[model samples]
Target: MALLEKLTPGSGSFDNREKIQNQAVSQTFHSAVNFVNHQYAKGCEHIDESTTVCDNDILKSLAFSQMLDRRCSIRKPHTSTCNWILETDAYKHWLQQSTGIFWLKGKPGAGKSTIMRFLYNRLRGECRRSPEKGIALEFFFCARGGELQRIPLGMLRALLNQLFRQDPTARQCIREQYEEKSSAFGYGERTWTWQPQELEVLLQDAIVTAAQTQPVTIFIDALDEAGAQFLSGLANYINQLTTAAKICISCRHYPTPPYIPGVEVRVENHNSGDIATFVNDRLKIGYLTEADSPDSMIWEDLKADLTKLAAGNFQWTDLIVPLVGTKIAEGESPEEVRRCLQIVPDKLGDTYRRILQNVIRQEDYSQTFLLFQWLCLAQRPLSVTEMRYALAAKDMVKSPHRIRCHETASFVKSDERMKRRVNAVSGGLAEVVQLLDGDKERQIVQFIHPSVNHFLLTEGLNLLSKLAGDGKELLAHQTSATEFTSNDTVQRCHSNLYRCCLNYLLSEETPIRTELGQVPGGSELDVRCKSSPWHEYATRFLFKHAEEAAKYRVEELDQGIWL
Candidate 1:
C-alpha cells in the first residue's frame, strides 16, 4: 500500500475517481511482486554468507565439481522406463511416511543407476511443484572420478553443501567443525577433513533444521562404487539420520550394507519390460531400417530373440543392439543382420567375444592387442588424444634414433590418423566422447559399459592374447572374473604401461609448422605446451606408473625397459 501510494499520480486527490481506483488496484499488485523479489534477493544473500563459514580453500577444490547436475545417464531417450518401483505400495508408503530408508540393490549392469536417477528426478520435480517440501540432497558416485567423488568424506561434504544451499541457517554444525579445526593450534594452524562421525553430527544438525519446516530427502546412487569402506556401517548412519529425514540408496549386492528395516527393491525383477523396450527402441533408431520386404520373418524373429536374450540386463541390450546395425548400416538386407544375430549369444562373455572377433582384423591383431593392453592397464581412462599419442610411443629398444643431439616431438601432428586409429581400435566396445573436466571439454576414450571393463580386464584381454598366439596371459583374474583386487595383472599391466609411458615421455617432437624450441612468447610458450592434453598426463604419471611397474620385474620385459 505504501509503495502504491508513493508511485501513484495525484495521490491526494483525483479528478476521475473511477479511473483512479482502477489504477490503484494495478499498482497494489505490482507492489506485492516487488516485495517478493526483494525478499528473494535477501534470502540468496543470506545463504551465500552462511556457506562461507563452512568453506575451506582446499575442501572447496574437492567440492562436488560436476555433481550438482550429474544425473545418471540413460544414454538415449526412452531407454529407461524406471517406473516400476514408483507403482509399488512400498514406494508410496515411504513417500507419505517421509522419514525412512529405502535400499535398491542389483547386479553390475542391471540399470540400478538408471532407476535411481529416475527416482531422483521425480522427487526433485515434486519438490519444485511444492517447494515447501524442503531440500533434497542427491549424489551419484563415479569410481573413475577419483577419491573426491567416491569416498565417505566427499559424500558428507557434498550432502552438507546441498543442505546449506537450501536452508542457510543449517550450516551451523559444519561451521563449528571448521572453526574447531582452524583453531586447534591457533587460527588456520591445522586443516582437517570431517570424519564420518563428525559428518554424521553435522548431517543430523542439517536434517533437523530442514525438517523443522518440511521433509528433507537424500538420494545416494552407486554405493558400491564408493568402495567397501563406505559400505561398512553406512546403513546404521542412514538409519539414524532418517530418524529426522528420508533417504534412498542403490548399490550392488556384495559386501552388503548393514541390514536395516526399509523397503528393499531388487532391480532385475522390475526391469524386464524396460530392458525389452530399450532394446526395441535402440535397434529401431540404429539398426532396423528395412522392413519384412527383405526378410520379414527373421526381422520379427530377431526382435523376439533379442528381448528374450536380454534377460533383464540392459548392458546385454547395449552390445546386442549395435550388432543389428553392422550389416544394416552397410546397406545389407535384413536377412544379413538376422544371420549375424543368430551367432551372437545371450550371455555377456560370448557376445563380447563375437564383437572382438569382428573388429580384430587379421593384420591389425598385434596393434589392437597393444592398444587394448594399454587401455586395460591404464590407472584412469585416457583421453582419445592421449591414447593416440600413447599408441604411437616407441619402445626404447625399438626406436632407431636412440641418441640425438636435439629432441623431437613424440609423433607427427596427425589428427585424422589418430581419429581413425581410435575408431578402429575401440571397435564398438569403447566410446570416444567429449566430457567436461571442470569447465573445459575433454575427449576421452573408455569402455562403453562396466561389463566391457570387466570382460577386458578378465577374459577379453586373454582372448586377444590367445589370438596373439604366444599362449601367454598379461594378467590373470581370480576365481571370479569380475573381481579387481589382489591380482598379479596389475603388476604385469603396469610394467608394460611403465615402458609405454616412459617412451612417450622421452620421444622427441618432430617440429612441423614451428621449429623445435621455437617460441612466440618465451615462458608463455611453455605454458601453452603444458596445455596439451597428452603432455601433462605423460609428465605427471610417467614416473608414478613406472614405480608401480618396478615392484615386479617380469622376465618378458626388455632389459632396456629396466633403465
Candidate 2:
C-alpha cells in the first residue's frame, strides 16, 4: 500500500505515471528483440550458426543472383509455321536417348538448323524433370561465335555452366575437382597442361560423375562450320562419352566428318512433308475461306505448288513461303500468289544471283560476280572479319603493281584495247568493291549451298578456261607482252581452279552416290567424261583447235587430262 501511494497521482500519482511509462517501453523493446531472435534462430537452423544473419539491406546483394539464374529462362519465341518442319518419330526417339552421336547432314536451306532448334526445345523440357536423370541440355549455334569452333570442349563447358546453375551438388563436385588439381599442382610444384584429348577425357569423367546424379544432353548445329578437325575430335569425344551423354550434329553432306556409326538423318526426305504442312498452316481458315474454309481447295493448291517447287529441298520452300506471305500481306489475290510461286527460280544459285544482281549497281556487276566466284571456290566459310582481311591483303598486293590508267591503255594498243581501257576511277572504287565483298562475309560466306558449289565449280571452271584463253590472247597482243610473265599467284589461282573442277568431277558425295556406289559409269566423272551433253560442247569449244584459242589447255591436254 505504501509503494502504491508513492506511485499515485499528484506527488505520488506523477511518480506512478513515470514508472508505468518506463515499464511499457521496456516490454515493447523486449518483445521486438524476441521476435527478431526467433527469426534469426529459424534462419540459422539449416545454416551454420557461426555465420551472422545478414541485414535486410543484404537483399540488395541478391538481385543480380536472381537475375543470373533467370536470364536464359526466357523461351525462344515460337517460330511461325509458314515454314515449320514436322517433328518425326525417328527424330523424337533420337531426342529422348542420351547415347551416341547423331549427325544430321543435308544441303544448305534443307531445314537442318530449323529441325535442330525444334529438337533442342523438346529436349530442354525433358531436362527439366528429374535433374538426376542425367540430362542437361545446352545449344551452340556455330555461326554465333568463334568459341563454337572448339567443338566438344566448347559444348561441354556450355552444358556444365548451365547445369551448375541448377545443381549445387554438381557445382560442388566441379569445385572439388578443381581443388584436387590445384592441390596436386602445389604439392609437385608442376603445372598441368591439358591437350584437347586429355581435356575431353576429364570432361567425360566430370559428366559421367554428374550423370550418376543427372543426365546431360548437348545439341550442336552447323558441324561443318566448326571445321573438319574439330568435328573429328568431337566425334571421337562423343564415342568416349557415349555412355553418359549424347550429341546431335547438323551439317551439309560434303564434309560429313568420318562416320561415327550411329543413326543418320537426312533432311531431304522430310522436305516434302514439312513443306506441305507449312503451306497448309500458312493458308489458315480465313485465308482459305473461298473453297470450304482455308483448309479446302486453295490450301491444297498452294501446298501442291510448293511441293513441286521444293523438290526435296527445304531452303527453296523457306524462301518461297516468305515471298508468298508478303504477297498475301500486300492484299494480293490468291491467284497472284500462285503465279509468283510458279516462277520461283528452281536453281538456288541462280535465284540468289538474281536477287543480288537486282540489289547491286550495274557497273559493279562484273566485280560482284567475280567476288562471288572467289567465295564459292574458298576451302571453307570465311568470317566477315577474315574476308575483310583477305580482301585488304589482295588489294595491298595489287596496289604496288597497279599501272596508271593511261599507261595501261597505252600498253594495250590493239583493237581489243579500245573495248576494255582502264579509267581514272576513285581509289575508293576498290575499297567500295571490297566493302561489298565484306558485307557478304557478314551474312555468312556461304556464297552458294554445297550442291550449288559443286555445279559452279564444275561448269564454272570450263567457263574460266575459256576466259583464260581470251586473257592470254589479249596479253600476247599487248606491247609489253614480253615484260608480262605468269607468276606464282596467277599460277596458284589457276591450279586451284583446275583442282576445284577435278574434285567436283571425282567427288563421291554427289546425290547419285546412293544408287551408283563408285561403279564408274554412273559417277559424275564418268558422266562428264562420256555422256554429258556439255562434254560435246567442252570438247568442241574448249579442246578442239586449242592452239587457235589461247584459252585452251593444249599442252596440258597433250600430256593427258586426268579426271
Candidate 3:
C-alpha cells in the first residue's frame, strides 16, 4: 500500500492545481489510482529500467526490524529462579544435538518465555565463550504486542536476517532473489510477489549453504502465536535444518506433539523452585515486615499456601504476590492484605479486575479506559510521548472540552515533559518500558500483561459501561470528559481515538518544505513531523479507526473529516 502511495496520480505529476483544468485533474487522479491498482495486483512497479537498487537489507527488515526490541527485554534468568534447567541432562543433550528441535511447552503463565530467555542468554554466553559458534539468534513473539510479533512473514524475515547478518556469504541464493525481485524483469509484465514459499526456499538454501561445522541453536518463542500454515512449514523446514543446526521453541501446548522427532521440555515442572523463590522474595519485600501485621501465620506457611495456589503457573503468582505487596504498601495492614489474598481469584482475568478496580477512577473511567483501548486497538504500539498528546486532543468540531495537562507535547521540544504527562494519563494502568531496538533504544507504552488485552475487550468494557453512568466532571477540564457510546463500547473507543488523532493532526501549527534545499526559515523544528514516531501511525491508522468507528456510529461521525 505504501508502494502505491508514491504513484498517487496527480500529486507530483501536476502540482500546480490552479493552472490545471478540472477535467485534466480528474483524468490524472483516476489514471494514477488505476495504474497503481493494476501494478499492485500484478505486484510490479513502473520505475525506470535503470532504477534498480540492491535492497536485500531492506527486505530482511520487512519483518525482523519490527521484531527487534519490541518488549521490555528479558536478558537473563530471573534472580529468584533456579538455573537447574541448564544443568539438566535432557536440555544439555538437546543443545548439543547436531540437528533437531527442543520444544518447550507450558500453560499460559508457567514462565515459558522466562525460561526461553534463560536459554537464549546461556546460548549467547556459549557463543561469547567460544567465537566459533558464529552467532545465536533469538526471537520472542507476543500475541498482543505487534503484527510482526504474531505473524509468519515477520518470523521468517527475522530468521533470514539472522542468517545473513551472522554470515553474509551464506545467502548467495538470497542475494540473487533480492537482485531479481528488484530487477526490471519482463519490462514490468508481472510483479514479483513476496510469497512465504519464496523466503522459505532462500532460508532453506542459505542454511544448507552455511556449511557450519559448529553447531548453532535458534530460540524461537511462541510458535502458537504464528499462523498454523507457517508453523507447519517451519516444523518441516527445521527438520531439514537439524542435520547441522539445533532449534528450540517455546509455546503454549497445542496441535498435539509434533510428528517429527523433537525434544519435549515442559516448563511447568522446572518452575516450581523458581516460583517458590519468586514468591518468597516478593513476600519478604514488604508484606512480611513486623511494623504492621494482623496475620499470625508463619512466613513458611504463607509461602507454601501461595506456592500451592500457583499450581506450577508463574503468571498467577507473578500478579498475586505483587498485588498483595502493593496492597500492604497502600495502607492495608499485612493481616488485611493476606485476608484479601484468600479471596482473590487465581485466574488471570480476576487478578486484572482487582488491579483495575483499585487504580481506575470511576468518574473518569472511559477517558482512562480510552487510553487502554487505544493501546490495544492501535495498529502499532504508541510510545509514552504519543499517548500524552493523544490523551490531550479534544475534537474542535464537537462541543470541545478543554483538557489541560500540566504538560502538553511539542514533540520535538518537550519530550521530557511529555513523559510525565504520559504517566499521568496512564494512571498506572499502562506503563513506559524501555526496549533495546538494535543499536538504538526506545520507550513504548504497553499493558502489564499480554492477557490484559482480552480482559479489557470483554470484562473491562462491561466495567467501563457501569462506571461511565455516574462519572463526575474532570478536574483537569471545564466539564466531565466521559464520552461513551451506550451500545458500542468498542466502536466508541475507536471513534474517540479517531477524533483524538484528527485533533492531533490538525493541531500542527506549521508545515515543512520537502524541497531538496532547506527553506530560509526551516530548522529541525520545521521538520518535527518527520522526526516524530507517532507521525506514521497518525498518517496511516487515523482513517482506519474512523472507518471502523463509522461501522457502529456512522451518524455520530464528524462531517468535518470530509472537509
Clash numbers, per candidate:
6, 15, 2
- The order of the candidates by TM-score, greatest first, is 1, 3, 2
Measured over all alpha carbons after superposition, the RMSD of each candidate to the real structure, in angstroms, is: 20.7, 17.2, 27.8
Worst 10 residues of 1 by lDDT: 475-484
Q: Which pairs clash in the backbone of model 3?
A: 43-191, 99-242
Q: Go through the candidates in order and give each one's C-alpha lDDT.
A: 0.63, 0.46, 0.62
Model 1: residue 22 alpha-carbon error in angstroms: 57
Stronger candidate by lDDT (1 vs 2) = 1
lDDT of 2 by residue, 1-563 (tens): 65445545575334577779767866888899999988866632222334333222122211223222221433342345313233555555665676767777665567676667666776566656544444555444453245433345555555555655555445545444444554566633336532445445556666677667665676767665555456576666667777877777777664346667666777765556666776666656355344334435665566686777665566666667777777765667778877776443355555333223222334433333334444554444444333332222222212234332223222223323211211101001111112234445122334323334443443433333333343242121122212213322233233333432332222322222332245435455456435332222222222122323235342332444332
**For model 2, what is the C-alpha lDDT against the true structure?**
0.46
TM-score of 2: 0.47
- Runs in model 3 deviating more than 4 A are 1-65, 70-76, 80-82, 185-193, 255-257, 285-288, 291-296, 330-335, 342-347, 350-563
Alpha carbon lDDT at 229, candidate 1: 56
Q: Write the per-residue lDDT of candidate 3 for residues 261-321, one digit (tens) a residue.
A: 7778777667788888887777774434554454435545766877876667677787778
Can you give the lDDT of residue 180 in candidate 1?
Answer: 57
lDDT of 1 by residue, 499-559 (tens): 6555654553322123354544555535634656555555556666777767776554545
Candidate achieving higher lDDT, 2 or 3: 3
Worst window of 10 by summed lDDT in candidate 2: 423-432
Task: Choose the strongest candidate by TM-score.
Answer: 1
